[model samples]
Target: MAGFLLILSLFIAPLGLSQEKVETIVNKLPERPWAVVEFVRGKVLFNGAKVLKGEKLRVDGSLEVSKRSFVKVKINGWDNTIVLGPRSAMELKLSAQKTGDISPAKYSLVKGACRWVRKKIEGQVEKGLGAVHTPNAAMGVRGTDFYLKVNPLLGETEIIVFDGEVEFTNELEVTDKKSLTSGQWGGVGGRYGQKIGEILNLSKAVLDKFGKKLNI
Candidate 1:
């Protein structure tokens, strides 16, 4: 009878813990944030180089990557940028836009920074998501390759286009997307995004890199 009681208590103890665990998780969901930011389905190494998949990121969720830990973002989506000191945080504000299939609202990834590569123009550009905000300016992208950087302490953003082009509008009129190609880049400071310029030549080195199957 003593042995039977021991076994029963063991099971009951775990069951009790499970309920408390569920309650804690449920309580966190609301005070935590409305949604989550799902990273690509791949392996991400932490400070010691370990590939991880299905990272559940909430607002202010952070994953620290040191020199020893390098991350490889695999798979598809509008996920083209990397975060600096990437708190691994999934900003609740952008969670919906990142999770939703389609929308007009834009999403911005601030801090650290990332460079982007655009896929063929097959989706809605306006409702599409693209933009990395930094302290000095913001980098806007549509169907092109661009880089963005943001420092947490400083309030600034900067952008550089490797291929294609971006629209730059600020204190003065900058280049339009219609004038970018290979070996060309641009930078902007201040509240940027919304729209960028275009590359006039489509049959150039930059566009060729994408290897799109022309309907012709």
Candidate 2:
């Protein structure tokens, strides 16, 4: 009986240690309202504090990327990644209506450019997934990879879609909206007046140019 009990303890000891290792990993993960900074280049700041790679950042404040700088973040509970380009400033007002649902995420791009890429979620339809609000325009995304450049001086927003679909609407005239798909481009405000610009094809050269800029 003593030898049998010793054998049983040997088998159970490793299992107990494995369980504790798993729990420690789970506890190290970032909680809600915080995101992981996956990449950073040049000077990046989150709410006035310098940002570093591999650190968890609270997304409740503003993010600024100085000239010749870039920052990439993965938000918790969201199936997407956001990259802010050089000279960009964005306010992260992100949330979900329900747990594990692709509810709308609200973010404002104050100036410069940003890129949003959504990973396909299994068994999830491509509609009403998220939204990005700029000064003059609002964009509704559906499992898409898109880029936005906000020209604050001219009050214009340029949107380019590389994959999936985006619904663009003028902030001043919500009735004026357009649906754009892959390889298409749209604009709001400035010369577009109270309506969104006519949807146009995105040339390969233009696509490559912006794609490289956003590091997509």
Candidate 3:
């Protein structure tokens, strides 16, 4: 009986962890398009510590694991955009288009999750300011319609082929590094091993959903 109980305990522990779902928007948010920062507690901090449009809420500091915090910020000038996941972080920078340059438009996603819809990105040296260099892989962000997902906890990164081609680099390979065409995906094993996962065909519905220019 003792040996049987030990085996069951191991299985039950993982199930308990998998069952816990991360909490969703806990605080009352202000009106849309305004800078809204939320805490783990049911309270929110509105426009510079002042309650402009949202309900008056005390700044709750419960932003650990039991709770989560996120901020929504937007700028008017730059035509660039970024999207993030839950409990994720990222930094954004944009370069204005020059007169005669091939791609004066450049965007850099330093960390976390971001979706970039580029106008014209065609060179490696033409990356906005600094490039996104993860622990194991490097991407020459040629202008394309795509997004990057890097898990902060797992230190794993996945580059999904949305549209256009992206040049990928790591450590081991037979020929030169490969570019991910549309509807394909690749994984980085953190040890210079490029594991090719899958290639998918675009059905009519899948094409309609991702092919059109939809708002983020």
- Name the weakest run of 10 consecutive residues (lDDT summed) in model 2: 95-104
77-176 per-residue lDDT for model 3 (tens digits)? 2233333334444432223333332223222333455444444534444343224444445556555555565654555566665766666655334243
Find the candidate with the highest lDDT and give its number: 2
Select the stronger candidate by TM-score from 1 and 2.
2
RMSD per model, one decimal:
11.8, 9.4, 20.6
Please state the error at residue 169 of candidate 2 in Å. 1.2
Estimate TM-scores for all models: 0.42, 0.78, 0.44
RMSD of 3: 20.6
**By the TM-score metric, which is better: model 1 or model 3?**
3
Q: 1-216, model 1: which lDDT tens digit per residue? A: 356445555666766655455545434442212222234333333323443544433332233444322332322344343422233211213333332343222234444545456554556554335443333344455667655454445444444555565654332333433334444544433343423433233345653553331101
What is the number of backbone collisions in each predicted candidate, taken in the order shown?
30, 0, 1
Candidate closer to the true structure by lDDT (higher is better), 2 or 3: 2
* Model 1 per-residue lDDT at 78: 46
Clash total of candidate 3: 1
User: What's the candidate order when arranged by decreasing TM-score?
Assistant: 2, 3, 1
Deviating ranges (above 4 Å) for candidate 3:
1-79, 91-112, 121-130, 171-176, 190-215
Model 2 over residues 110-185: C-alpha lDDT tens digits? Answer: 9999998887788966656457889889988568889999989888899989888888888888888889999998
